[model samples]
Target chain A: MELLLFNIFNGFIIGIFYALMALGLSMILGLNGIINFSHGGFLALGAYMAYSLAPAIGFWGALIVSPFLAGFVGLIVERVLIRPLYGRDPLFSLLLTFGLAMIMQDLIRTFWGATGLPFEVPNALTHPLSQVYFFITGYRVFLVALALLATASLFALLKFTRVGIRIRAGNADLEMVSALGINIYRLRAVNFSLGIFMAGLAGVLAAGRLGLTPTMGASLIMPSFVAIIVGGVGSLVGSLLGGIIIGVAAGITTTYYPAASDVVIYLIMAVVLIVRPRGLMGQEGLLE
Target chain B: MKSAASRHVDAAKPADAMSSQKSTRRRVAASALVWALLLTAPYWLPLTGGYTDLGSRVLVFSLAALGLNLLLGFTGGLSFGHAAYFGLGAYGTGLMLKFVTHSTPLALLAGVALGGLGATLFGPVTVRRRGIYFAMITIAIGQMFYFVAVRWNSLTGGEDGLTGFERTNIHFGHAILNLHNSTIFYYFTLFFFAIGCAVVWSVLRSPLGHTFVAIRENQKRLRFLGVSVGFYLWIAFAISGFIAALAGALYALLNNFTSPEDLNWVLSGDFVIICVLGGMRTFWGPLVGSVIYVVVQDYLSSITVNWMSFIGAIFVLAVLFFPWGLLGFFQRRIQK
Candidate 1:
């Protein structure tokens, strides 16, 4: 029972990571109409930046700042490389980002080397809370709490902020929003950075748990894509729910047959595609 | 008794006929030039400081990209997961030679069947989605195969990849064809490549091919016209999948090794880039794209460790400047 509980908790944490990732990806897919393949690259960039900044600013300071740094870089990239490709076939943007991902990964490898770097977790968060549940480390609990906090803050911002409302409106109908005289270009740029910010934060947290490697984010990107597909496009909450469902399912499968864990999530996606083709919350014909 | 419309057409017919005849001549000359160069590559390549194996590698990639172009360029489906079928073909051939049989022909057939069947079975699910969703679903689907290859250690040889498979020499009664020779292997690959080109060419000429183009041109219009767009897309997917598998089978034979990388999304991206880089809309675009890509990759990886950066830059530059590709650009210029 303890083992099962441990796996479930672990899965939940992993699911949260996927949800954070899917949320960022979903935002871009919803508003920008481009699948940011380099989101993974941005993720590793965030973690690496955090790693480099930690000694200068301390762990707490670096964690808060690095994601913002990654976001700033994303804003520039969006302005230069991604902005022109808008209103074109999605293929061009997809290929362009795919190339950008390669460049980012290669640059990361060039600077940091290919070896994995261990992130320094704070001592206060390393210890287990109790003897009964030895698996429940303070770091793990902190990760879950912080993820929840971030997600809640995002929801609140979207609900209350002026920019947030505009982003939402843009997602539903871009032409109408533009016709209303809103600067959709500037809105897209902001939304793109916002999505990258989520990836950066996920990276910082993921590095603490999984360690920093140039290729680490590559594997995670696919599952997040599956999460979006299963959750249904154009739905943020659905993405969150989908991520947890697959993560927990994989976690449970890991107990009996470890080899089958990876394939099981794909099975769920296949099932979802068959039963609900439009996804869980996808609006009809909302290609935007 | 001739109508006024017929008389008008008759007056303009001579000029139109001359232009059409000239175009036909130009096309035939271009085809002859390409064939002549390909046929003489073995002799000329050595003179240009190249190896026979490089020629085979180019053909393999060309075949893969060509197959992908059928769906991506002609059928207008952005399938980002095609590497799954390509990898499946390599795995199928490698497994057959490793455990099932020793004959190269049978192994090739088995590999093609395995990869092609996987695509056919999965086509329904993939074809159900269009545009971005289609691209996302395909990538997810490829990852499934990639994980299976990684985890099935006992059968697939795990991350180390499947090995111990050798391409056996064939027997033709009294005369023996030496498969171990690089030149012979190049010819073997070229033979298959020719078959692939012929298949694609003939298909493009057929009514089904026209329908595929129609679907790409206007899906909603075709739907309103009572055509099953999904069904036609599925057919394109399966055929392209078959061609990708054939390329993979040839690739396995070229190296005598197969790995999880064969089925990776990175390679899928490469295939798509090859199509785009060469000119997706052009019939010979895949071939032209594969040549530039494979050669540049070979040359770059030899000199610099930062070869991927250069390759990535190629992808960016290609998309930004020449979205139509080299062939497409030239074709446009000539027309103007």
Candidate 2:
């Protein structure tokens, strides 16, 4: 029972990071009709940025600055590479994003070398929260709370703000939104940058918990994809739910069946695809 | 007899004479040139010493790319799990050669059969979805197989892979073809490549191939036309898998080893690159793409370790400037 609670707690903690990553990907896909395969690279960049800047600004300031930097990079990528391919075949975007990912990965490797970078947990969060029935790490609890706060704030902004309404309108019908004299292209640019910023935020948070490495993005990227798939593409709530489910399942499987843990998420995806091809909360015509 | 033949010829002349004779002549000359190049390449290539092996590797990659072209280029389904089938073939041949008496024919057969079996089982489920969903499901399945290969230590030798296998005899009945000769192996690969290309060419010209084209153009419209889109997709998927496995088995025989990297997503991506680089819609695109890719990889890696960055840049450039691929661009130029 103690082990179960521990796994659940750990799962929720990891799940929040997954949610942040998937939320970015979902928004990009929903608004731009592109999968943004390079989103993982942004995550890696954010982690490295935080790793380099954390010592000077401290963890809190690094978190604020790293995502903004990532968002700036994303805006440049959108303007230069992705914007032209908006009306062309979707595969072009996938290919371009994949190329961008390769470039980012190599850039990280050139700068950071091939070794994983060590990151110290903040002094306050390093202390244990409790040691009673089940031991809980203070840092993990803090991560979970921070993730929740960020998500809630984003959700509230999207639900209530005029800018959020414009973003939503643009996502639904780019042509119609443009017909209404809205700067649809500029809106897409903002959406893409915002999405990348979320990915950067997730990356920095993840670096604090898991350490930073150039190849770390590869590991997280697939899981984020799986989370989005399971949660239903284009739905933020679905991404959160899917991430938590996969995170817990992965944690439990690692504890129980070590050999299958690496593939458990994939197995779950296959089963889900066989049963519900559109995912749990995915709407029809999303892929089309 | 001469007068009757002349009358028949004269009757057929109107339609034949109206067609562009120059285009026909150009096609015939080009085909002859290609055949001559292929026939003489093995002999001419070995004169350079180190190039023989590279040439052979290109041939193997070409065969694999040809298989991928059928699914991606012709059928419009982008699969990210082709390496699973390729690995299945390689491992099948490796394990058989390790355990049993080394017979190349048997190893090849076993590889194709196992690969076909895998495709037959999984193709239906994978072909049910389209676009990103299809790509995701295939990736999941591929990863699942990768996990099995890693965990099943008894059969797969875990992460170490099936290694140290010796090249055996190319036995036909009681006749043993020597396996040690590089020239002989080159000929063997050429023979298989020629047959594979022929099969692909025939399929492209058949009614079923037209159905595949229709399916790619619009699945809904094809479905409305009463064609079982799923059934056609399954056929393409299975055939492509079988061909990939055949190439994998040949690779094992050529190298005398197999590794887990054979089934990695990178290998799958390589196949996709080959298809796109050559021209996905053309019959010979994958073959051209594979040849160029393998050669560039070999030459560039020898020059510098940062070849991946170069390859990535090339991929981006290809998407941006030459989306129709090399073949498509050349064909359009020729038309002009």
Candidate 3:
């Protein structure tokens, strides 16, 4: 029972990470129709930034600053590299981002050196919080609470904020949104930054948990993609649900058949594709 | 105006026919030149600081890219998971040699069947999705094979990779054809490459190939005509899988080793980029692209540790500047 609970909690944390990353990918994919292959790169960049800055500014300051810096980089990438390919085939953007992913990964290696680095968290959070639930460390609880807080704020931002509503509106009908005299180029740049910021946040959290490596984000990127797909491509809430579902599924699988853990998420995706081709919340005609 | 236009077209018919005849001759010459270059590569490659093995690698990758181009270029189906089949082919051949048989022909057959059958089975499921969703699903599906190869350590040898297999000599009647020699191996690879090329060429000429093209141009219109677009797509996907598997089998034979990396989505991206870099629409674009890509990669990796960045930059530049590819760009120039 303890092992099950432990795995479930672990899975829940991992699911939160997937949700955070998928939210960004889903946003860009929904708005631009371009799969940002470099989202993983941005993720690693954020973590690396936090790693580099943590010693100087301490963990809290680095956490607050690193994602924004990553977001700024994303903004620049959007304005320069991504903007020109907007009206072109989605294939071009895919290629462009794929290339960007490679370049970013290489750059991370070049700049930070090609070795895994440890990210140190505060000492207070490392201790177990309860004797009954030895797995419930203070850091784990803090991490979960932070993730929940971020997810809620993001939901609130989307629901109540002006830019968030415009983003949602643009996703529904770009032409209609454009006709209303909004600068979609700027909107996209902001949206890309917003999505990347989530990736950045995920990266920081991931680094604290998984340790920092050049290829750290690569493993998480796929699950996030799966999460978005299973949750329904255009639905943010669905991405959240999908992430948690796959994570919990993986957690449960790990206890009985450890080797199948990595593959079970993909199996779920295949089943979802077969049973619900449009996904749980995918819009009609979206597949076409 | 219509009658005048018709009269002008009728008057220009002879000239148009003459140019077409000239073009046909030029095409034949170009094809002959290409074949001659390939056949004589072993002789000239050493002079250019390249080896016969490099030539073989080009042929192997070209075959993979060509296969992928069938679905991607011809059928407009975006498959980002082709490396799954490619990797399966490699593993199949390796396992057959390691555990089952020593016969290369048998191994090749098994490899092709394994990989092709895998794709064939998954075709219907994947064909239901379109565009970027298609790409996402294919990639996800491809990862399943990758994880299996990684975790099934007892059989696949896990991350260290599968080894202890070598290509054996062939005997036809009384004479023995030695394959250990690099030049001999190049010829052997070329023989299979030629077979793959011929198969793709024949398929492109068939009515089904035309239908695939029509589907690419307008799926809705074809569906309106009551054609099952999904069925044709499955056929294209399966055939491409078969060819990619053949390439993967040859790759395993070349290295005498197989690893999980062969099945990774990164290789799939490389194959797709090779297709785009060469010119997806052109029949021989992948061949041209493969030559440039392989040579450039060879040179860059030799010179700098940062060759990945350079390769990435190449993708960016290719997409931004040369979206049509070398062959397509040249074709455009000729047309103009």
Candidate 1, B213: how far from true, in Å?
0.6
Off by over 4 Å in 1: B1-18
DockQ of 2: 0.37
Q: Per-residue CA lDDT of candidate 1, range B170-241, in tens?
A: 888988778889899999998999999999989988999989877776788899999999999999999999
Error of model 2, residue B296, in angstroms: 1.1
- TM-score: model 2 vs. ground truth: 0.92
- Model 2 residue runs over 4 Å out of place are A132-135, B1-29, B46-50, B173-175
DockQ of each: 0.46, 0.37, 0.50
For model 1, fnat equals 0.63
Q: How large is the i-RMS for each model, in angstroms?
A: 9.4, 11.6, 7.3
User: Scored by Cα lDDT, where does model 1 land?
Assistant: 0.89
What's the number of clashes in each of the models? 0, 0, 0
Docking class of 1: acceptable
What TM-score would chain A of each candidate receive against the reference chain A?
0.98, 0.96, 0.97
Candidate 1 per-residue lDDT, tens place, A130-221, comes to 89999899998998888898889888887799889999998888899999999999999999999899999999999999899999778788
| DockQ, Cα level, model 1 | 0.46
lDDT of 2 at B195: 81
